[model samples]
Target chain A: MKKLLLSGMLAAALFFAGCDGTSDPALPPSSDFTVTFKALYDGQTLEKFKSYDYDTYKVNFSRFNTFLSDITLLKGNEEIKISDIEWVDFTPDSAFGNLTVSVPVKFKNVPDGDYTGIRIGYGVKPELNAKRPNNFQSTHPLSRENEYWLGWGSYIFNKVEGKADLDNSGAFGTSLVYHCGSDAVYRTYTFNTPIQVEQGAAATVEFDLKKLFTINGSWFDMKIPANQFTSNDVGNVIVATILMDNFDAATTVIQ
Target chain B: MKKNNAGWTFKISTFSAVLLIFLMLDACKKDDPPVEDRDDDLVAIPYNPKSYTIPKPEIFPEVPVPPDNPVTVDGIQLGRRLFYDPILSADSTQSCATCHLSSGSFTDNKDVSTGIDGIAGRRSSMSLLNVAYVSRPLFWDGRSPSLEDQALRPVEDPIEMHNTWANVLDKLKTHASYPAYFRQAFGITSRKQITKELAAKAIAQFERILISSGNSKFDRYLAGDPDALDDEELDGKLMFFDEGGLLGLPDAQCFHCHGGITNTGFSFFNNGLDSVASLNDFKDKGRGEVTGNINDNGRFATPTLRNVALSAPYMHDGRFNTLEDVVEHYSKNGKGVSNEDPLIRQLGFPIPGTNPVKYSGLTEYQKKAIVKFLHTLTDIDFVNNPDINNPF
Candidate 1:
């Protein structure tokens, strides 16, 4: 009878605890992380249809979009994941002059803490890249029909599209499209800087798109038009490699 | 005594006949379906809405179905009927099919469609074939975002069907078949519950089902059938897709705007259609008028080339009558305007001092081959799909 009474008391304790409308004590307090990715030309925010100086020519960017995967913050050996995948679209419907053409990816339930740095996997990782659009639902970001190239048997990892006025003439004539794709083009970069993830506020990380066009000191020449880079086209692969090598230098923590 | 007995029998027989008549009348009254709402009339029909899986090309992306309006079998049927029915028009002489015909891959085969009031619309009737996956902000100007919203426009368009929603509602409420259809499709309890939104939803469901057959020669070739395309067609396909760039063939650059499985991009582009003096001088101001952006002048939604061979006269205004003409137009250094897509300006071979874009690189033979290749995109199976045909 003592054992039965003890059991009943335990059951009552569990029932009342569940009905208290309180969260589990075991889980840590988490906060939302808002990471804004900006596409830029040189040091300023990139604007579509606006002319910018590239070498001797004036250039215009029509599109600049990339898929950032496995965005995680590093705290020593520990990692806090922000997003598995984000289709960062810098291609605005209209031109925004001075302001950054950017998209913010918000992640909720991020365990608040101070972090060493952040690591971003550029392009869909090998595992997710293996699957087709049909593998996922329509709502999945990777299910974009236009991004997936049947020729490459993979998603087009990055699109840096623009036109260059080869001559200083008024008309912008030359088209340059460097749509990098394939497993070989997939890469990741770690920005090794202190990042703090607080409970109420968001810690931002900025990726400059202009850095993708340059490495060390040299800038990618837009006059060299090799539009077909969806697959391992030799002419395009050379161009794509130049840009992919610059990925590490492109990103950094803003705050 | 005998006469009294006979009188009693006659009276009993008369009473029995009257009782039987009364019971028969009562039975007849009970058998009639109860008028739930006497004024508007209840459509007494079974409302078992079966889910519909819109036929999609295996090579294509997932068919985009809005969250609120899940497709139903009855909904599709009702939509199909409405699409072909002329009753939606003010004059009862035109329908959605008046502009979009199935045999022509949902194009009326006219340069610009003449509306019910005999007025010509500014743009061509875009092909409804494979429109389910069309990158959003639909229509040439990107004015309407959803097919449901787009379906509502023509009926009310002064030059088009030229009918008000009020008139359409009244007609649908009183429609002998539509009320029953509404009950089956949307589970409307009464005919009065028939709404423009429900009608539009039904039509949207029907439009979503109008997808590609994916049995085109290009699709077959991509699906690993090596013999699907001929030598010339293969060459054209290679050039069009810039696969020939590896083989030292010049990038035709058709895929820049018209790439992807559906042969179209997701955004609006000024495809160098007209040589405007300036952005403001554009006669139509197509996408510009919609967005209020001067840079967007002369831009139109990039259309799919699934059944392009049948969908001429081509372009937003249906300017190009034949595929050959279309190719020639692209070959020429486009009349350079401020916002003309760079792809057009870079059409020709690069020369030393002269703007390489100024010259047309495509030889006469190459143009023909490209046109021949475009023919392979014609999906006869889609055009002949009986499921999407006129319900009438």
Candidate 2:
């Protein structure tokens, strides 16, 4: 009789425990992190739309917009995706202005953990890339007017606009516009640097603009025959390839 | 006896607990009614929706269709009727077909189209042949986002239809067969639901049905017919498609703007028609007016040469009356305008009495060949397609 009573008590306890387990699973504590980006001219922070001298040429940028997507945080074999997709506009005319630079992107619900690296896709995700701007919501980043070339049936992933003094006359003469797109030009950059985040604390990541425009320590000349602005041409493709390669090579995680 | 009483008490408690749980589950089930009963208020109406599948031509790219406005047989029929009806105009004398004649490849041969009020428009009517494939901005000025948006403007433009949307809608609502046509096309319950948006969508559907003749000499050549074009036409084809070295000839730079099977890309460029001192000096402003950009001044969208042989007078203002004149203008390499396309600079055509001019890098014989090649793009079958003709 004592054994029967004890077994009954134990079964009741087990039933209550099972009910509690199914009611609500505990979620890992998370925090927010802000990733900041800055445009530079030869390692110096840039003033928006201002002309800067480089290698016998004076350049002034009017627009610079890029798609930074699928930002992932890595620690050994484990990975945590922080952002699905975000458009970073470096144009001075952009709405978000924090000092000279636009507002930094803040990611929420990042699980508190130690990260050893960061990865950023320089273009749109493949699934979304296949669709035209008309297919997306009007307010979506991909739906920005003039970003998608309907004739090419592709989105312009990166739009860098400027004028350059090709002859070094101190006057901007030639248009320096590089509108890079096409799925063939998409690239992902990974930075292997240690970063840690505690619950409720924010972490920051910085991208160096000087490195992005340089190759093997030499600045990429916008006036090169293959780097000129074109919507549909082999030259545009070459310029896009060089730009993506430079992005992957020059990107570094801020410690 | 006390043990028996305790056992009975436990049984009664367990029975009550089971009954309570059953009642709770029963209540949950009652919360959601059957799917059929939930929508009892909605009336069921019989609908036989007809499907339309556009014919795919050989060597042609897939037609672009807006997601919200898929082609339908009923919709196309309604659109055809609406297109031919003069009810869209303030006066009953002018219809879309009035300006766009099937014999002229859906373009009026007039330099500028005459409106219902006998007023002439600024730009000539553009050919509708293969217009559905245009991915760039619509109209010569690159205004309007899509064919649907383009359809809405002609009715209200004071220079064209000279009618208001409100008046047009009223006319459509009062028409004997229009409300029924609208119902058949869009499944609207009442004539009151007929709107300008739906009308535009229907008209766009009809416009999209106008495609090029797939049996053009160039298309036939692409489709493995070696004998389709003669040697002169073939040489012209090479010159037209040349990107510096097709036949070891100097690049005429024709294909830079008019390449691909469509023979024209969708982009606006100032081909140097006017020599303006500054961008503000351009009289027409063309694309610049629409975009409000100074650099785009005098830039006009490139028109397809598919039925160019038929749709003349040429250029945005219909300045070139003949194909020879058009070719000559290009051969002159355009008067050096401030914002002229970089590609439009001198092509080294030596003038007998004057300085070497920037021509189209084509000899007289080569220009003749290019003109012959332009003729092969004319498709006789497209202008006579029975399905695209007037329904009335």
**TM-score of every prediction relative to native:** 0.88, 0.65
TM-score of chain B of 1: 0.89
Cα error, candidate 1, residue A254 (Å):
1.9
Of candidate 2 chain A, the 10-residue stretch with the lowest lDDT total is: A91-100
Model 1: clashing residue pairs?
B348-B361
* Over 4 Å off, model 1: A1-22, A54-57, A92-101, A223-236, B1-43, B348-360
lDDT of each: 0.79, 0.72
- Candidate 2's DockQ is 0.03
lDDT for A146 in candidate 2 is 44
Supply the DockQ value of model 1.
0.39
lDDT of 2 by residue, A49-95 (tens): 45677667676654567887789999989999988778876643222
Pairs clashing within candidate 2: B346-B358, B347-B358
